[model samples]
Target: MGNLCAGASPATDETIASADPVERALAIAKRDLAKGAGKWQELYSYDRSKLLGSGAYAQVVKATRKGTQKSYATKIIKKGQYDKSVVIKEIAISNILSEHPNCTKLIEVYEDKANYYLVMELVSGGMMFDRIVKKGHYSEKEAAEAMAVLLSFVSFMHAKGIIDRDLKPDNILLSDDTDSAIIKIIDFGTGEFMKEGQTLSAGIGTAQYMAPEVFKGKYDQRADIWSLGVIMYILLVGFMPFGGKNDAAIEKAVLRGKYALEGEEWDEVSDEAKDMVRSMLQSDPDKRATLQQLQAHPWFAAAASASESAAKGTRMVSRLRGFLASTRLKRLAMLVVASNFKAEEVDQLRELFVTADTNKNNLVDFNELRTALSKLGRAVDETELRRLFDAADMDGSGELDYREFVAALVGQDVVERCTTARHGAFKDMDADGDGYLTPEEVLKMMPPGSTLEEAQEMVKAADKDGDGRLDLNELEILLKN
Candidate 1:
């Protein structure tokens, strides 16, 4: 509050001292975000003339952080555009969902006197439908992969009582321009959380993908499933499920719950796939597939089980060992390195992670890791397996998160190739810039509920020089050795 940036204007003392509840909430939220984001990087500069896009409430501009090349989409929203609750809600929901590998990560948030800044991950990959249309062909495997991510996203959101309200190919995007790029579900501005047995008025969504129940003005999360089914249908074929020359006609067909799988496109598509689509597009929400049924559907299961070979599994185990041998700080460095890679760069490892998670819980436990590594000639010792799992579980969550799994599977060459990455890792831990990492500094990286004692023990293990702190050399050795 002393001055977030130079030449910046803050709310007047009168406004700051307002009795308004919303003003107080906004102030609290901004303070918390600033704390979590840590030290500021000075004022963000953007060219007002060159804008990305502008909506009623905000104008988006492409922003690159001062010291780094990483680009973020920063939305400068008018403070009065919406209530403080809306902005806070968006920030809260986005932060929660960003943990999923497929969601657009929220980078940082800031607010000034007259405007609020929301910085988010920049996804350059074209929209899902456009990518497919340009590629000229979409395979069964591609369709299945897209659906799998979308299905998992829906499952994840529904379990948390959230509804996207808008679920369409246009809202989904690839991480990058690659055949193996993972899907990034986006645009949760219209999202809402439902109370049990509640019927939603249903927020804004495209007509073609909107469920019939949505048109009827009361629907629930099953509407998301319907939208996803429309996407699968479009991928399997080359056209919309309820095609029309205009949106009105499209909505009419959606209400009728009529779509054809009787064209030349359907001949090549499996009957199993068609059946699944029909189940999802039911006019009656009750008759439509529930999340559980959709997940267990034969077509979906058949599509999900379609990865190649056990040799990949054995190879992944070897990588996991190298990852486990590294200290948590080093492991985090490697993860940061991996995250910067292109979609194709880590696609194979991504696949391996998905395959290793047998229950599809989006995390890998020791047994799951065991199954993935079992293709090796020698049976992995239980003790050795436990050790590996413990090492990869960065947050001590008893499981390997997707990023942790990716860090383990990324080649050592990739991890060490970026000197910048190594230095970045060291700098993050050396909070005092003393060229050494202390237990107190390391504790910053540990999960909530982790103790200074645990951090001290971590330091003891990595303090190779025995001076009770980690130097740059020790960190590098731990990263690669």
Candidate 2:
């Protein structure tokens, strides 16, 4: 559901032709969903009493999985209230995006006769709007950081032929209360997958954020870009771009494509920021900034400090060399340890991941990593580069997903953090608890269909004592190495 377009209602204005914008938008997204089907067979459970957010059909609540300290959010969908078809697609999308640092990670899905529950990574920070107003000042750098997350999300989804169909501040949440909280984009209620050259002819999104073309019901992914423009405007100006007494008035104002950009509120924002916002809010979809143009915009580019990049790149490359040199088992152990890193610590690493994912596929291929490294002046020999790439490609997926990237970014503090967290992971994986872990014990944690031999390979990589099993000390070494 990539298209986030305008208004909750259709315009009754003499100038408008469409009678229902929201319905038109939902029809496009649901029509797309009708073409695909899926079922979530995994079992999941959560406490339904601690509600985080709720609506007519579903309620999200805080949840805790047995034997783990991780906090999660579970969206419980009431039976007979919403179509099962929509539920399937939402779960499928969650599974697809579980690895992205910016998107919610769907942990499990289960259903009972009365409801369906989708448990996922919990976002603890308040809404983006609530945070800004409470903080009382929205800095340009902070706005840029948020924009970067949204742009990356949109770009990644577009690369996969998916449309968010609904992109607004309400659907975007933060991972925590800290200033560096990671962006967690949630709610794919109106998402759809599009083919090349496809167009959605309905405006299916919140009233104020909808693009003008969305109101006319003839638009593409760019409508989400427009919605982001609305968020950006509010971030800098301290008010919505198109304000009105009601949904109808907001719809009319959005259709007019007029917003304040020269008042006192706009005085502190950079011209480049204003330019990007203006381009995104363009009434003519064709006149809007292309995704490539948006990614390359000077507003975002200026946020990157060349000096900082060079310094960080130097340290990261050195870490890469060490990571590549470590045993395969250590690398595998680091993946589990990566999950144990506090969300705030991971948020600090996110900027590096986003910058390296130049193509925005939520992946950093060998070439992309090389190019990114070179750009940061941390170039290395081709042979060594291949070694590092091969080392970080944990699933042999030929690329480093975000978790793998985080594992490979180990420095002293990261190592200490992982060392402290390694015990819980070891105890969990050592299911038999004989004071040693066998390949059989670890296989439960591997991907589905992982072979006995693959698990053996992992254990052998760090079997320094020459035994076929590992003790907690070995697990610590495996994670810390």
> In lDDT terms, which candidate is top?
2
Clashes of 1: 0
Model 1 misplaced regions, further than 4 Å: 1-42, 47-56, 78-80, 304-481
Q: Clashes in each model (backbone N, CA, C under 3 Å)?
A: 0, 15
> lDDT of each structure?
0.72, 0.73
What RMSD, rounded to one decimal, does every model reach? 20.2, 19.3
Q: Per-residue lDDT tens digits of candidate 2, residues 206-323?
A: 8888888878887788788888888888876567889899888998998777778896346556788889999888899889997788888998766543356665666576668667
Tens-place lDDT per residue, model 1, 1-481, is 1232432223345544668633543454445554544233364556678786687778878887777766787877676546555565566567767878899887878765577678888877768877756533355567777787788888888876678888887778787888788789776777776766888884468888888888888888888888888888888765787878888888788877767888534655667888988888888888888878877778867655544453354345455666776666667556555556666667777887887788989998878888777743324668877877777777788888887887777766555556666777677667799999888987887779889998888888878879988888887777755
Candidate 2 stretches with Cα past 4 Å from truth are 1-49, 67-70, 303-481
Q: Candidate 2's error at 19, in angstroms?
A: 39
What RMSD does model 1 have? 20.2
Q: How well does candidate 2 match the true structure, expressed as C-alpha RMSD?
A: 19.3
